[model samples]
Target chain A: MKLVGIAGTIEDHSYNRTLLKFMANHFSDQVDIEVLDIQDVPLFNQSDDQTDGAPVQYLKRKIEGADGVILATPEHNHTTTAAMKSVLEWLSFKIHPLAGKPVMIVGASYFDQGSSRAQLNLRQILESPGVDANVFPGNEFLLGNVRDAFDDQNNLKDDKTISFLSSTLKKFLTFVTTINDMNAKVAAADWESEDLGAHGHVDTTIDGLDMHAADWVDQATKKTNAVSGDTYVRLDCGVLTVDQLNYFLNSMPMELTYVDANNQFLYYNHQTDPENMSAKRAPAQVGNPIEDCHPKRAIPHVKQAVHILRSGQTDLFKLPVPSDGSKADMHYYQAMHDKDGNYAGINEFVLDILPIVKYYLGLTGQKLVKDPNATDALTGASKKSDDAKPDDVSGASANTDEAPAEKPAEEPKPDVDSVSGASANN
Target chain B: MQKFIAMVGTNSTNSTNRKLLTYIQRHFADKAEIELMEIKDLPLFNKPEDRKVPAVVTEMANKIDAADGVIISTPEYDHSAPAALMNALEWLSFHITPFIDKPVMIVGASYGALGTSRAQEHLRQILDAPELRARIMPSSEYFLAHSLQAFDDDGNLVDEQNIKKLDGLFADFQIFVKISDQLKNAHGANYEEVRNLDWNK
Candidate 1:
């Protein structure tokens, strides 16, 4: 394994530097350790970076080239020296050189407490999100009273300290090698494509349900109340009550939320079993701005999606919310349109379909028999049994009433199965 | 010294990623025999036609087959690898199978904050195709973000630390390649057996 030891202090007679040199010599057989001097590294400045200074760039490259880094620090004011901080600051420019880089920090000081405070401070800086340097989780090396610990030639005289440092270096070498081996093994594994055979057909079962049906029913019922003083709308087959409309939206075994064109939180279905829901929706959120309803981290993504939807560039956005284990919760957002083809709002649905997905992929012991009545169950055609036609569940004419007559809805095939197949192949 | 084939995924005339590859070649000049492989002359890969093998592709395959290791530097386009690079890889994957058990290292330079991390990931997936089977150097991903500021007018890496990093990667890569070569020889042409050998030892 190759390791680079960086002496944190720039002083000519620094104990930390001497200690690093001793380590390099001691571990010569197992590792090729090089002691890098940071004296030439310039104070980081954004303007200087524009010109691309040679010294700062060199420092960044050196750290990048190493398998692991050994930062031998010296204490000043109970913290890391200015030199160490300056090097870290330079490496953290637009590109983070230290991100995920395994690092080990050791400090040597004249005081009895050694440079423990400096090492602690350095660990915090290395772990900061911006730097993200992976410091060894435990086993700190603090050489206190360093003046008498080493011989005149800067060699370690203490047998106890030498043994401690040797064991730490050996463990550090193993850590570096293990990571390297794992990376090689992953790279060696063939993951580009797989023959999923007929497994790709499973995702096709859930395609093309009327995304706007629930909202359209709600709007049509509201208009009936305003015009005729009736709280229900008479449909083609039967009388549709306001309570039935609410039931239709909430009975889909998924969480539903709607945001208007003005980015307002209009409504969200209250889950009967709150504990089973992935995201909770409170009644107080109604009429609030969509931005306020989402956590701050998710606000930017929501705004971008809303902007894209309002522009009519694309009407659908699908994402998988990460879960604890192998299964992931799926979220789908579809843009709703008014009678004149004006953008109205968005309908968001979050569903946990891991069990269904697992069954289709043959991961579960269960078999997937094509549910002949799935289309009927999805379109509410099952509710109006008298008007239900076998062809009405075909998906070609389900949205004919709302969609323009010029463009008929295409047959909803199992598109997701093919997509999942492609992902499986990758 | 081992011979390595350095490939840049982009065919752009002034690609910074290509410049990065040239810098890497210079850095490893003392330790390895680095050769620059150009994909500009190769035609776009046609699945049916490439199965028969074109002369240019044949020559490129031969070069890869002869090299001890392969180093690729790529730029991300639309969150994936450039079409030109993918085309070449497809040809190599279908025809020669030069990457089978081969030692490969990936590096990238980009102007964006995420660098070419996404593209590198995409490339890793592609290289893992059953036919390619390239053994890539695992954990260390060299993403030189803000690459516009990473080099000087002379095309040398401005950051000395970055040069040292390249040096370290080359050192590890050399060892990895040597071990792979030893394993291949020991197994006596049984690719599967060689692949299954515990490489860490």
Candidate 2:
């Protein structure tokens, strides 16, 4: 049996990572272990399938192929690590990759009990899902005083624990081998249908659930009770009309969150208008704490933008949120100024322009904004006006003061790569 | 009378899974004594020759030896079983075929989507060892989805759907364990009887 050791931790000096290294060396002659990194994994989001920006596809494949997995986890916020849980969230796309897999969990921590509570908490989260972990006869490896557990070479110091671990592997191997032998032909019965829910169509697969998108969307305040000046005013609820919704939805390049300054979430145009719900994949995020939805790594950048917008500056920040291996980048523009030129709190807009780019590339159909008079008939601002115009388009006369005040018949084409790169820099 | 050991793998200080398993043990509490194995203490797995057999390993082996049957309640991680729990399994595998001919039931729970189906599948694959007697529970029975929210503070299944699933799984597991124990004690003589199982139920 190939003994795959799962190492989770993006950092270089992670203690759990070190423990994985020790396991690698200890089982060098007997097993093959690989460290699976969660760094490249985008947050899982189901709606990403409908958007031009899609989530990663290969991460789930790795978990499916592993024999016995060993997880080296660190404790965070008094429980299992966030990155670790994030990986699990991604895995939830599948029916049950972890269900019957033989697993060995070992953790390292600076504190006493060796991050035991975190490990235990993680186990609870794992077991809650149906893994028959060979937990009995009490299988726990808590390396309290983690410093002592590792030697000068950064390997496990104790020899006895190693033997026990080896023994555990033997037992697990036997169990795995036995099970596989019994169910040897089980793979043949998998699917006869061509559309066997391929690509996470089945809720049990990785493609079905959008964990990254969920996390990103979840960061915002989902519950919004409008409080205007003192009285709780109720804005329109339920779906709007098809024509109005379609114009509002397709007119803007970005996913717009119309906030009336006090950081209160007001409205977001549903992607698929109610009338055309079949072809439409509405944005999963409706009313949520906008801040909570950002990537942890990108939180600081978002804060900086929020700060600038709050301080009366129309901060235009562009970032390439990781979309699978390639960048399905988006541009964020927040302006505190109101429609009346009065200072409102902020009008935040997030636009996934990958579709626009793909359209521009001739790889897809109509341009992102297909309106005949691309600009607003009233405001004279083009529908894609807020979208960052690459230098190729930016240098055009439309960006100049001398350009025609009347609506232009054609939108200036942009240098897709350059503009996307520019958007990602912030 | 032969004794059966129920090993519950959980990390929560007050785990709902543990509480559920505890309630099940109570049913057998008067009929038979049960050993509740605590895994929070085992040392990290390293080669014994390199690190020596830690006391925790020996204690774990002792519990396995004393029990006629072992029931493990595993936690799901990364759509699989927790590494900590797996590590324990690794330790047990290294010690002996503690799972050999030992009757086992795999049950799982989750707070979201399809329950712990992934973890349970992984566990089933592990338990498929020829030496291990896996009393496989049907997918519908073993899975308790949105389980975290189902249990109240007192560990009772507040939702009817979850309660029904849990009850069915527990009942099946009890039968599986009892039958498995009887077959194990009878050795190969009762192996034929144990093999004739209605796994679908």
Q: lDDT per residue, candidate 1, B69-112, as tens digits?
A: 99999887535555457667866765356888789999998987
Instruction: Work out the TM-score per prediction.
Output: 0.33, 0.35
Query: What is candidate 2's CAPRI-style docking category based on DockQ?
Result: incorrect
- Candidate with the greatest DockQ versus the true structure: 2
Q: Write the per-residue lDDT of candidate 1 for residues A1-426, one digit (tens) a residue.
A: 778889876566788999999988878988988888777765433334521466666766777778889999886534565567657756765657677678898989885777887687678778766578778878899999888889988899989889998998888878777765564344323221211111112211222222223353345435444333336878768886767867777787888887666555557887655465765666654545555555554443344455545554356644455446465566666789886557777788878788777755553234446667556333322232233232221111111122122242444334344453344333
- What TM value does model 2 have? 0.35
Q: Give the residue spans of candidate 1 off by over 4 A.
A: A1-426, B185-201
Stretches off by above 4 angstroms in model 2 are A1-426, B43-53, B129-140, B145-201
lDDT of 2 by residue, A163-231 (tens): 777786666667666655443323212212112112222211222233335442344333232222234
Scoring the B chain of model 1 against the true B chain gives a TM-score of 0.89
DockQ for model 2 equals 0.05
Query: True contacts preserved, each candidate?
Result: 0.00, 0.04
Clashes of each: 19, 90
